[model samples]
Target: MEIEMIIACDDGEVKKLGYGKTVISCLSYREVWPEKIKIGIVHTDGLDATSILSYLIKVLGNNKKSLVMFDSITIAGFNVISLPGIEKLTGFPSIVIYNYKPSIKNLLNALRPHFIDSKIRELAINQIKSYEKIESKKGILYIVNRGVNKEDAIEIINSYQFYSRIPEPLRLSHIITSQISKIINPYAN
Candidate 1:
């Protein structure tokens, strides 16, 4: 069976870590959607969470079977803290990208919040669970690396739904977005 997954990624570099989304998208391309898949992007002039969510829902349609990924890029903290409403909006299985350097297990150990990442993960899982509001299924959230190489790619994939890692639809989206970004922002690195 083909698995459908949605990933919300970080969209800025540094704090605007949108590249995190690209990394997830790239992995999706190489590992998941090897051929054809529908992909879309949603961004905003400001961090208007409600607007972003609205735009995504409108474009993706209300089919729960469709995976809706968020490019958590640098904006996840904002969502976790303020956009509780968005959690309710995502009626499909959703994944957000977190691009920290350490493994979630390691971060849980060294971080001052003790199990902060774990807590957030649990929170996401639970919130999505509540949002799904259906039996026999629930939305999922994943934390993965911005891998540097093919081996790292494997490690990153081990963290998510697939056996080898990375889903195909998102990977294609990354390549398409990168090329488009260059054309759209020629000077951007």
Candidate 2:
């Protein structure tokens, strides 16, 4: 069997940048270590999809099958990324995982202040509502996926949640980005 590659994208915030630094990780899913980790900066709680995606594509190259996982569709704040666009662009199976049951309307109200652009706000709202539910040890996980069906995505999620309720790629991403953010800016939240 071929080893599956996972490109897990996460962002870290610094007070200096309006957004933060996005860490795009090239990881072997089962092995649980990052093969390539690249950092790309984004506006503090702002638009990062384009820059982060473009950078990862260049680093990862073409015609390679991989899985893309996001800690959330809206990173930072209302800064949203598209799973379908990424799946189409990179030909990778993509999954968006959220541990809590998300309320899009409530999120929209909270995030409305951050986004001046209506389009960005709308996209963020849409992304927030795009997930289907997957029950896990922690709680209900809301997920949206492309290049993989609902049944397969569930199986994939279950298979990955070995050590904990948190998936390996996402758990590793949280660890790495948090550390990187602190190192990048100790004073930052």
Candidate 3:
């Protein structure tokens, strides 16, 4: 059984930290849908990948590895984190989906002031492997994938997306994170 952990982040009054929600689902060919299994929350400061890793470990408990999916590579933390960092640390192949291709130039421009070497960051960006773009009757999406084959990625997206252009897990995660952040931070609207 293949399991996917879909992630989405919601920001609150806390400017530095973001509330990230992960929706875990078991994928099966028979159902052609993601079976909801678990949901987890991670509190992260901008640019802190360690917090994310720790929260995931706490949530996952026994399951050390699963296919990790994120609405974007940089969440919770402005563009302060790296996709390779998450994939390498967790040992889970990560798949990042977007409505448009990520902007390398803009990202580097944003990071230049903070980091000593923009070139190294550029190299990391270049190494990201993009599989075929997913174009369905519902919508068009760009994907950056690591550790999973192209066929499986396509299948995962197809199985999870039912009601909208966004995959069900992503949509669910978004809703969960939004509601959770509001409760966690009463000041946030």
TM-score per model over all chains: 0.40, 0.81, 0.66
Number of the top-ranking candidate, with lDDT as the measure: 2
Number of clashes recorded per candidate? 33, 5, 0
The alpha-carbon lDDT assigned to residue 155 of candidate 1 equals 33
Q: Give one digit per residue, the lDDT tens place, for model 1 in 32-58.
A: 444333333333222344445544543
Least well predicted 10-residue stretch by lDDT in candidate 3: 21-30
TM-score-wise, the better of 1 and 2 is: 2
lDDT of 2 by residue, 1-189 (tens): 232666677766434542354433333343555666666556655666655665575466444556777877776555677766676667677778878777887777777776678566577458666678887655578888867777777767776776776687778777777677667664333
Give me the runs in candidate 1 sitting further than 4 Å from their true place.
Answer: 1-45, 71-83, 97-164, 186-189
Per-residue C-alpha lDDT of model 3 across residues 3-64, encoded as one tens digit per residue: 54443332322232333432222221123433333333333323344345435533543353
lDDT of each model, Cα atoms only?
0.35, 0.65, 0.53
Clashing pairs in 3: none
Model 1 worst lDDT window (10 residues) = 129-138
Ranking by lDDT: 2, 3, 1
Model 3, residue 69: C-alpha shift (Å): 0.8
Best of the candidates, TM-score = 2
